[model samples]
Target: MDIRPALESDLPELLALESQSFHSDRISRRSFRRWLRHHDRVFLLAVDQGQALGYALVTLRRGTRLARLYSLAVAPQSRGRGVAGALLKAVEQGARDAGALYLRLEVASDNQPAINLYRKLGYQQFGCYEDYYEDHGSALRMEKCIRPYAPGGDSRTLPWLAQTTAFTCGPAALMMAMAGLPGGYRPSPEDEIQLWREATTVFMTSGHGGCHPLGLALAAHRRGFASEAWINIEGPLFLEGVRDENKKRVMRIAHRQFVEQCAAARIPVRHADIDQGQLTERFQAGANILILISTYRLDNMKAPHWVVLSGFDESCLYVHDPDLGDTHPRQAADAQRSALDCQHLPIARDSFNAMSRFGSSRLRAVVIVEAGPGTAPTPAPAT
Candidate 1:
């Protein structure tokens, strides 16, 4: 059997194979035809003696390095003939050639044979959805890094810990950064609250205060990590929302205290902007970054939020968002499973730079965490 791109003439067999492979969530003939003509979508088929055996469909988005394996189906007669695997391999190559660094897919949870095949082919489960299929079955989300390997530890291994509260994104993000290093701190609710208590600098309009860069940097340093902070503006931050002079005064005092504490602890505080190129370089050099972004791009809210810089590809940057808003609000039991979709979440390089700035003044803040004393920089993974 030979694998190749699907042509318009292959539509009838493609629809036939798709119907025989799955009982629900079948792709429409129109979608198949449209994707075949689309430049960013890859549709391929495996054929033997001009008989279609299997097919795979991959979708790519502009300005991102991610590809989604939208569908993969093999004819019933082609079972155990490695047709499914060959179709999948063809899709991966097609996706990579189109500039995708990763490929993601969702498979039914109860499909053990398909799951086994995916695992054997290097796809790992990252997240899942409950009652996802038309038949109310769960769907397991899986992904593979299709990009060529580079030096340094893969940041995708870092745990995805969502913020327990709306106002604790800063502390929650710092917790994830610390947890990514060798002998890193284990994150828990207790630590999350304590870090918030220790780092909060500005009292917001209603909710608990937002954290300052110095506050979070000092908190990480106290936990024995080497931390540095970069801020685009000088003086008190997160103050534009405050209407009460008393509250603003309090926030200013808190910011001053954090600045003094950071200085006494010998943490570097660079009062300048750190661009995306610099962030990518630091991340590749084995440091985890805690960056502040405007929630407008992420959730349509004009507010500040925090996330960890998990990884970077040629055209995209991946983040572990502490906010679970990417999906619907989830129960605690489902948070872990839902977090898979948010882990190593990709953002276009240009979009990330724009999202990193917050508020009308367009503030940018970052906390860079290096390995602690006596802990060498994380090494590259064993192939």
Candidate 2:
């Protein structure tokens, strides 16, 4: 069978094949016709002698490097004949031609054959969904990097570590950055806790407090890397409202040690919020920034969380958010494709600043992890 773009005339056969492959969630002919006529979308069919065997539908959004594989179906008679594979290949090419850097799809968890095929094509499982279909079947969301995932590393996929405790965002974010570096640092749970112990303020509003920029940068520096820091708050951060004198004293002592370490190591400290322009300059100069941000802009409840702001452009910031659940939607897509959003999130610059502060102090802190000498710089991807 040959693969080619589907025409309006192919809708009836496309709907038929879709119905054959799906028991409950099949695309209608009307929807297929509309998608066929739309720009930034692709509908392709595998056919022989004018009879369609399979079809795929994909969607592309401007300003996002992601392409969604909304639908893919093959007729039962065409199973095991490579029809679905050919159609998928065509969809990938079409997506890349449309400037998509990633192709993402949601497949039913029970669909082992489809999962196997996708894995065979180098699609990595990045997300999941429960009760995703009309029949309440769960789904696995997968993505293929149409472009290299990062400028340098073991194939652009950053190793993600979920925070074991509420206050390990700093550790988790640093761990991800380490994993992406050339050394392939594999961080363990023990290291996670240790990093927090080394970096955190010990007390904030409640529970264990978040990390300080100097503390986090010092932690990275101790691990054979260089560090620079920019922070808005001075004279003991995260101590806005502690009625107890003892707790305030404890926070101050810890802050003093972190500051002392920075002074000894000569870690550059900027006692102000780094301008967006300066951030761009540092990124281009080959350093990854770890941002301490307020979750209120994302989750509506105010709390500090940490993330690696790995990439940026004039319009957007691309981050590997460690607290996946706390991140807000930069944009919403269907449930299947939504899984990829947490792994690598894109946020508007203006919206990010509004959320990057904490407490009544409006405190903002950043720690820079400088790329090692001779390490490749991250190139901005086309969105």
Candidate 3:
């Protein structure tokens, strides 16, 4: 059998196989047609004796380091003969070639055969979707870490933890940075919420609360790590989200309080952008960064986000982004490295600068947490 890219002529056979292989949630001919002509995606066919045995459709979203295996189907005649395995492997290799740090897929919960195959292929279940299919079948979200990622020294390890709540990204990132430092503490979900309570602004664009850079710096300092803050916005932030004048006043009061605590701690607060050059300098100086950025690149939402810059190389900056939702948000892949996992992200130089901000003005803020050296430190904290 020959494995190759699918052509327009293979569409008819593909549609038939898709319909035959699955009882529901099959890709339509129109969608298959679209995938064939799309430049950033790959649609491969396993052919033998001029007949299609299986087909795989994979997607690499723009500005995301994660590729998704959207669809894979093998003809009934070829199922027991390992046609599906070959197609899955080819799509995985294609995703790696496309520079994807990981690949994710959603399969029905009851599809034991597919689930077993995915497990055998090194895909681990990370999430679930209820009633995802038309037949009311729940979906299991599985992910595989695609290898040949950006190489860096093992001395710097930024442990990753997903924010339990959306507004806790800043605190969660601070938690990851602390978890990376020498003698740093490992925080639990409860600890994350507690940290958020201390650092959050109490009000944001539309949510419970979002942590400020000053708040995060203070949070880090209280934990025995030396912290510095750099923010582009001079005045109180998150006030624009509060419509009630009295509520805005309260937010400003809280913001001022956080700043005062930071000042009392002698944390160096700079009113300037933390450009790539400065970021690199800090990395070289042995500092873990908690950057407050906008979530525009991962999603179109112009909101505040926090990520930990754990390591860097000549090609990309490795960070542990706290937010997991909408990490893969585009149809075309970014020319730069994005995220391997929700916690471990690799951002390219130019794309990162654009991603590291909020609103039309692109507000930037970062907290540099520097700690003393340790002997034989591991990249990820031990349980």
Candidate 4:
């Protein structure tokens, strides 16, 4: 077995390997030729016994500090044999040598095996797009930062929250608690609400930039509450506000951003249009959940993050905001209105109702799980 730079002679074999490894809509021979012609492109092939086992094609954009893994494939017979891993490592080294700061790729959402492999290799999920692929399957965009090698610190160390119970409140509380300190601290009830707003503000303004949820979600998950976010809005926002040629491009960027956030925190995020019945059906399948209902605060007339959906009784829903604290689980006339206000989305109750009357637009609740019943819950930090 040998790993080496791909030659012109390898194109036919490479194309065959790609077709066998992927579905019908993958890269074509013409596309492969164009990539090979690019000055910054790096294409590597792994062969054993004179047959192509796997291949990787990477393109470096010097000015943008980005290197994209355009195509990667391993023969079906060669899978689970480390061929893919070897090709990936070669691509990483090549990208780094080319002075790229970030490496990016897109994989199908349902491709869990590939997703896990990328995660293990330090690739973080950034976002996803609905029907981004030719077959209309969702695609997950992932990235890996190429930094100068540093020594001494163990990369696998769990975050400080995992080491101690200093910040062990629920998602919202934990985030507000952390905002009290320059680096980390606990906040008062008033401060908690303010901090929660600030943290989420950071997320929205930054376009959800970090590798994980900006504030409370990350803090809580680190301390053992498995928390996730449900993004509810109108039909495929990515597909809206863009030209046909650029729709895929925009969606790819949007999805990559969200997926990276979830990947950073090891949380799952489900994207859905509330009008879709299937979305709500999937949301109800989770356990120990908390729903956040966003609404505009009357004082400012600006939509701010408000209220947590704790649970529901027939005809009425419950919410828990930091401001309300233990006296939460408030009632709302309509559950959909509660969801809309919390998210600050532009859809009106009447308009939303008109579209969702026959169906439900409620966003999926973020599921939270405690470590175990035997373990005592960590106390919140003193304000």
lDDT of 1: 0.82
In model 1, the runs with Cα more than 4 Å from the true position are 1-103, 112-140, 144-156, 326-337, 379-383
- State in Å the error of residue 355, model 4: 48
Model 3: number of clashes? 4
lDDT of 1 by residue, 1-383 (tens): 99989999999999999899989888889877777787768889999999999999887744346688888999998899999898898899988898777888899999999999999999999678899989999999998988764323353367778888878888889988899887558999999999999999759766679888888898888888999999999999988888889999999899889988988999999989998888877887778899998877544567788889887656677888887653233323211234544567677678888888988888999999988898987743331
Q: Pick the candidate with the highest TM-score.
A: 3
User: How many clashes does each candidate structure show, in the order listed?
Assistant: 1, 0, 4, 17
Which runs of model 2 end up more than 4 angstroms from their true locations?
1-105, 108-157, 326-339, 372-383
- Tens digit of per-residue lDDT, candidate 2, span 1-383: 88888888887788788778888987766667777887767778888898888888888743345578888988899899988788888999998787666788899999999999999998899678899889999999898877654422112455566766767889999987766665446899999989998998878775667787788899988886778888887889878756677889999999999989999998889898887777766655556678877776554557788887666644556677676453334322232224355455555567677767778999888888865545555533332
Q: All candidates' lDDT scores?
A: 0.82, 0.75, 0.76, 0.48
Output the lDDT of residue 267, model 4.
73
Window of ten residues with lowest summed lDDT in model 2: 328-337
Q: After superposition, how far is residue 234 of candidate 1 from its true place, in Å?
A: 0.4
TM-score of candidate 1 to 2 decimals = 0.67
CA error at residue 159 for candidate 3, angstroms = 1.6
| Candidate 4 overall lDDT versus native | 0.48
Worst 10 residues of 4 by lDDT: 157-166
Assess candidate 2 and give its lDDT: 0.75
Question: Which pairs, if any, clash in model 2?
Answer: none
TM-score against truth, every candidate: 0.67, 0.60, 0.69, 0.40
- Badly placed stretches (over 4 Å) of model 3 are 1-43, 47-52, 68-150, 153-155, 326-340, 372-383
Deviation of model 1 at 309, angstroms: 1.2
